[model samples]
Target: MKTIPTLSLALIGALSLSACQDKTAAPEDIRPVRYAVAGGNAETGGARYAGEIRARNETQLAFRVGGKVVAKLVNSGEHVKKGQPLARLDPSDYQLDLAAKQAQLAAAQSDLAQQQLNLKRYHELLAKQFISQAQVDAQQNGVNAAQAKANQARAVLDASRNQTGYATLTADADGVVSQMQAEPGLVVAAGQPVARLSQDGAREVAIQVPENALEAVRAASSLRVTLWKGGAPLPGKLRELAADADPATRTYPARIALPGDSHGLQLGMTADVALPAQASRQLSLPLTAILDLQGKHYVWVVDDKTLRVSRKAVEVGAIDSDNAAIASGVRAGDKIVTAGVHLLHEQQRVKLLGQ
Candidate 1:
């Protein structure tokens, strides 16, 4: 009777332990992943860059000769017609030089006339046998030498006149004065910029693009310019891009040429240049979402209904802001695992954390 009771207690304890193990087992561990929808951030519409209005042609106005500045006829922001005087140098010195050149020219002409008269008289003397043929030839040579001196003096006088004209700086074309480098009483060298002229023509938008965004800017399919003063955007095209980046900011300088006859466009106005995003299927995601394995790029895409993650290969394109553009192999509205991509496996069931 004691053995039977002891065996029965052991059997009941074993059954109880089995029942507890079946009732209270550890739960299955599922990984929670951070994910983001494609086509978000800077990829939705376009990428914008801060820009400024500018003229297509900016010319540095300078004098052809060095002189002391006597007057500045036009101030910065003033518009002038072609050949309009912008500044003037002291013409007194140039006038004096012109007078001296005139005097020299008169003296040369007098000498030339005297030589011609002497040559004519020598010819008559030689005909009468009063002078040798060699003497007449020598007088002819002296006349030729005097003629050359007169020609040289005439050229010098013409040059002096041109220099006098150069003393007055004038605009070569119709333009607005953008900057003034010379002031009254300032002596400037020849070819030194006296003022900057912004010629009236096609306008352009200038912007600085960061190093990483250069490719996106270059590959932009379409571009538009929006003024900061609130107006409709104007169509634009890429006109210039710097080959190397700036040393201080590490940015590439770019210029977008606008159409001719840009009304309401003013110089130095702030603007925004828009580089439209790629076509409808283009998607962009964070760098963490892209996995590089075996020299290829991949992203973990989650199925909305099942919440199961699968590795999918994607083609990457130019960088747009902080996101990498997906050229192909991805579509809009797909949920991509944005963090801890390395730990994911194919067909892994995942739970998303609140974004």
Candidate 2:
């Protein structure tokens, strides 16, 4: 019985030693890290900018002659074709002036015929020496004077006819009548604007960019334009940059050309333009890897030897789709925390979840 008890005690001690050894040898539990993965790739920066849709060509239609507007053939928002009649002035005054000129021209023609006959008679008499040379010379002078008067009268007649034609206003090109400045019975001055015509053709988007961003705008390759109705994004090429900044707002204007048929687009419609930001080869990482604290952006980077994490400040450039482009602070080859960045703090020790 004594030997059995001693053997039992020895067995219990060995088991207790084994249990302690097992406890010491066991591996520590590693917390699983949840992360989102993003690949570094070429991406375009998207920015929403307000813009205006404008016609490629717009012209002011005016009258050539001043008169009472007798009739207005077109109204605002009306489409007009080339050579279409837009408005007409009172033709009564112009018609009377033309008729009077015609009458004067007829009288001048009759006088010219009579003068030619008198000149013929005078030359015949001078050759025969039947009449005095002084008398023949006087008749020739009268004939010359009559001919000059006839010519002047004919010129006057033609001018009156031309004035008559100027009473009507016509469109010089195909366009839509955007504005009407004249109404019936309205007396307008010569060369006064009668209507505003917008030519049917290409469309452009005008955007105002900050003066400080002018340098980046000049370096950008292209811009993105979006239509308001469908929110459709279309590629637009940079066409022109304003020479001077706006005095009131301190912004530079930029014009971009939108491709495709512009017939459906109305003048003065609003557009959204995305201007390219400064080009930079940034360290792009997943959005989940970025942590926002105290209104500042930061990220977690891993230490290679110790497998620890440290928070670092980053200047973000553009959010390309889902990835954040890091302008500064992080390098290309740095091991960034793909997941579990929210759970990390400055100089926090960490173990690779999988490794």
Best by lDDT: 1
Q: For residues 26-101, what per-residue lDDT tens digits would candidate 2 score against the true structure?
A: 9854445543222344554555569888777778988889999989999998889999999999989989999998
lDDT of 1: 0.89
The clash numbers for all candidates, in the given order, read 0, 1
RMSD of 2: 11.0
Q: Write the per-residue lDDT of candidate 1 for residues 50-142, one digit (tens) a residue.
A: 999998988998998898998989999998899999999889989999999999999999999999999999999988999999999999999
> Could you tell me the lDDT of residue 302 within candidate 1?
94
**Residue 39 in model 2: lDDT:** 32
Cα displacement (angstroms), candidate 1, residue 36, comes to: 5.9
Q: Rate the local accuracy (lDDT) of all candidates.
A: 0.89, 0.80
Index of the highest-TM-score prediction: 1
TM-score of each: 0.70, 0.62
